[model samples]
Target: MQSDADGRLTPGGGTDALFWGSLFRDLDREGSFLQLQIRQIIVSAIENGRLPLGARMPSSRDLAAVLKVSRNTIVIAYEQLIDQNFLIARERTGYFVAGLPKHIGAAAREPGGATRDDGRWTSRFAHRPSTYRNIVKPLDWQAHPYPFIFGQFDPGLFPTNDWRESARAALSVPEINNWARDLIDGDDPALIEQLQLQVLPRRGIRARSDEIMITIGAQHALYLIAKLFITPTTRIGVEEPGYPDARNIFGLLTPNVVPLRVDSGGLVLGDEFENCSLVHVTASHQCPTAVVMPLARRHALLQAAQSHGIILIEDDYDGELMPEEGELPPLMSLDRGSSVLYVGSLSKALAPGLRLGYVVAPAPVIRELRALRRLMLRHPPLNNQRVAALFIGLGHYRSHLARVGSVLLERARILDRLLPQHLPHCTWSRGAGSTHYWVSCRPGTDTVKLAELARAQGVVIEPGDVFSIDEGSARHCFRLGFSSIRTERIEAGVERLGKVITQTG
Candidate 1:
């Protein structure tokens, strides 16, 4: 049985092409082969009785066209399925589902096996991490005409071919042997070497391999450090409007979380440092506000850290994405007393999903972090670490950064020019190399309302309320990120948001 040209099933009966298409809609493309994915889809369909025994399958060419995959890929998938007895090819016609054991072919028609309604589990939990106010962005942000959301990458800027080349190299037999085994609190040596030789130098920092540890991301590094250092009596200072995750991570351990002030020069140099045992600062580029800390302030902070015996956790998450003009050294690089723990991520300029980040510190600190990390998840996937090492070693990492930095610089300049014209009612701050604008509307204006209105107009924005520890302090502020939106769309998006703002006012 086969479908007619109109794609409708004929009286002879065949698996509908529409059904086949829908079956593979949610295929995981991250780490799987298309041929294997297709084969698995067919196998699942057969096992679920969607493709009953003797049910005809679509021709290779037709299915390939529908799936938008190469003809060779479809043929390979069909041939492999046939070899596995999940399918049987009928010469000159098409393939059909093969007869299988009763257990294999039978479908459990009862959707989602019965379950008892257990009593509430919230009371059993020690902490409720979910109740924390978090930055919310639509999962379908890409579908919007203008998505000014932070920390997301524009697909066009991703280095597809270069990354694929690196990934392929990592899959080689020797490379596989290097990363396949359970590392158990260890990271890929090659990646560590690459970070030491290639990455750290850009920030004017140097470290021995023993002083560095790989993390799933900068967030994971923060968690490990917090678990090891923070106690109920420990006084930790963070920026007033700063990275919420850092504050939350610290708050979980201690109630002495202090909200420090941030001005144009970055974290204000005040007596607040005297009360802190540790301070978490995003010195390279401030989290919600992309204001770079000046060199003078960097020195002051270091001095304060040394004087007060405070340990500074520097999150250089976007350090690599800074502009060349006024780039300042990371605190880790400038510290002579070893008071700074530096955390960096390749995910900011690269892809966030990669979750490759590292912490640079004194050897003793690294040892403790490694042990804590081992208890949590041992280490980040070795395969990804190896691939990132290959990417850096091959010089693709810097080149990719150069290209993305240039594009983002242009986008930032455009925002700078357009904001004054389109949003006169609001003020914004974007330092030299910042990728986002911290925008403030007129007094008494609620940006949460503005964001809701802007989103209805197909423009996505991030309300600044979540970044504030004081809750209501940032009610009139918002953040606009240009990394995810296309350059040409910037003007239109801003203009549309301007109209929404006027309407709201």
Candidate 2:
């Protein structure tokens, strides 16, 4: 037995003594939780044969020292791996890889790698997906000094102690008995109770447990809604400059993705939506633009939907983040005809790695979706659902929400002060509360090029081209998210952005 150091293994533990820590050395862990990153790395190694079958892995202590994470973090990752069957443990010996694929071809290379055989994937498609033109921000964005990327969770805002406590509570014998089982085609009833009472009521949207279903995240929720309502013959209405991912999802199922115009008041309610079978909207804080759709407009949009027999899927993503006084109630709250289906997520307001979201619709719609969900994922993780229930049950969710709103509001104020002082030439739309700013450059400026070049300077910005259904006409717009950047970095990042804007012009 080589039991001298932390890396030592028991005699005859396994075949190879592999220390594959360098494989994750250059990986990015920004905006994501540590355990997830480590889990993903180990899974990738197993699939790629870098960690072959029966190969002994480095001890948890040694790997923790190498990765600069806590030994407990490595242990947690290992436990999850063991749970998922990617690794196995001896009674006292260190862990070893459990599974190895029969073959690892060039096709099985790292994610997004383009091998020679990759181009033929288009042949199997019924309709090709839309060509997304936006820059995919790197995952380890925290490693960068300036991150203006949208949709990232601020690590500083995570309620670690509360979440850990919630996890501990969920793992208790009684609670474990409740959440550890398959829950086949069922959700954590406690989490639904929390959502109905604590979460939805504030937004003025109320629902029964039968009317809601948990999803992998808001993205999965949106995808399911699109599958339910959209088809090749159906006309779907989307905002001109809306959430790109939503647009792409709808486009995949329908040939008609109608791009309606978005102004200061949000998506224009007009004849565009009249003929649409379904419409996707971000009414609270419009994606990309950060504009709140007015209350009057909300009523009018509902009226229009009723007249046209349209189903409106309201993505109430940022409603919880707004200041309570002036915020408009969600359209779902205002719907008397049961025409509005609401989408809400813990991922955006809490943590993306949790991949937890929910949909509120008619009970019939929920029943159908639950059947479909059973065919897809069965249900979102029982543990995540239960822990989330406790987090809300203990009031940590509301407290965390208030703290995040305060910090984002502070960041918004700082961004407002800095943007004018540094980049006076550009115009922007700032909402009462939202994570991002929609920036419109000078008449002839190419924001796409500016964004591409700014990355080289360590300032990552999201170009606006992808937000629009029509990318050709959206070259001068871009977005800056303040959620991830420190208040002190706002000025310099915008100053550097200003210089790049000037350089591009």
Candidate 3:
């Protein structure tokens, strides 16, 4: 049946009957099973775009009546289709075409489904984004014997039961009523409340609902901030050996991207920072370097930002995965005038695929973000927000963090003992309360070569070149993570990796 303008299919007697008839006509009557043939036909129709997106299908009873088949057969076929991505079943709206990819369920209707509308369309664009060259990991990273990749969670340690429980709680009728619909503010109020109550307190931050905004993740939060604050005329400062992703975001917005030098103490805040309109600093557990900015320096940075009227963007990378001791409070807690905007993520702590993070800023900034968010995605899936909130309210968030802390500390100790013994000539950074170790190699020992050699030996590690912009991807340094690697494999992984480092050195 053809759909109305709203994509609602109406049971137009002749057309609807004939449409199903044509679809079923091609079905193999001599096939081993009748239901399987019908399922294949429907799958083919969806993939070929014969049944367009959101074009509703007839009711099971109606389709069955038209096709001269038992309702049970049609029902089973539809359920299987829904299980796959070929179709989607709305709660009350009935079955609909899910807009599955052209490659699935059927052979191509024709080569390259849609031809070009306008020739050579590359001539126009609002702003061309910067090319982000991330540290490339193999697609089969999981199958590898050793993986020392950073900012990942060990799947074994994931709070599966706890997360499932929280999800169940969120899915209940009362909680479903809370987050099932869209919000004007583009964030779950319960989530904001939980963040204010549970997550931020550990960082020593106290923020009102007006001052907080839940984003798709920290990456999205950075994009919103850059979109609002950065312009061609604005001078923005980022750590020299900073996050390449953040640098890429700012690069897309403005050409005046200043790479600020970072010493062992963290972003070298001085007269250099005073000239910029906004500065992005990862003070707590500096990216790649893993250096925690000293409390004295944190105060000085706030003083500088306050004095110069420079807004600071602090990406609290891995700030939540701190070990048993030696961790500093977030800079946001110390910002009396609210000059700092803090970005925190669940990706590091919980799971990267979850794509949940939040931004803590002044009330005015959050208000602007709400409008921007409404325009772009209308608030990350409320279901995820609700699940995260329930996770926090149930005390799983803290307990999960504690579990991760213990796991990481033991891994860190494993690396500490093995790295020095294996690669005796190399020196490394001893940054505390982080998941990875930022190792500095000998003067000419390019860690990139070492990383490649290590990979060949069935070990995976990150080369520290992408971390630096000024010195062309710092060749002498590399980041080694234990977050995803198993404790048992830690020794062998480092042993093989250290042999590569020593041989290359």
- The best candidate by TM-score is 1
Q: What digit string (tens of lDDT, one per residue) describes model 3 on residues 446-489? A: 77778778888989888888888854458788888888899999
The models' CA-based lDDT, in order, is 0.87, 0.82, 0.83
Rank the candidate models, highest TM-score first. Answer: 1, 2, 3
Q: Lowest summed lDDT over 10 consecutive residues: which window, candidate 1? A: 6-15
List candidate 1 stretches off by more than 4 Å: 1-11, 14-37, 43-73, 82-119
The per-residue C-alpha lDDT of model 2 at residue 401 equals 88
TM-score winner between candidates 1 and 2: 1
lDDT of 1: 0.87
Task: State every prediction's TM-score relative to the real structure.
Answer: 0.88, 0.81, 0.80
Total backbone clashes of candidate 1, pairs 3 or more residues apart or in separate chains: 0
True-structure RMSD for candidate 1: 4.2
* Candidate with more favorable, higher lDDT: 2 or 3: 3
Residues 291-317 of candidate 1: C-alpha lDDT, one tens digit per residue: 889988899899999988999999997
Better-scoring candidate (TM-score), 1 or 3: 1
- Candidate 2 local lDDT, 419-449, one digit each (tens): 8877788899867667888898887777778
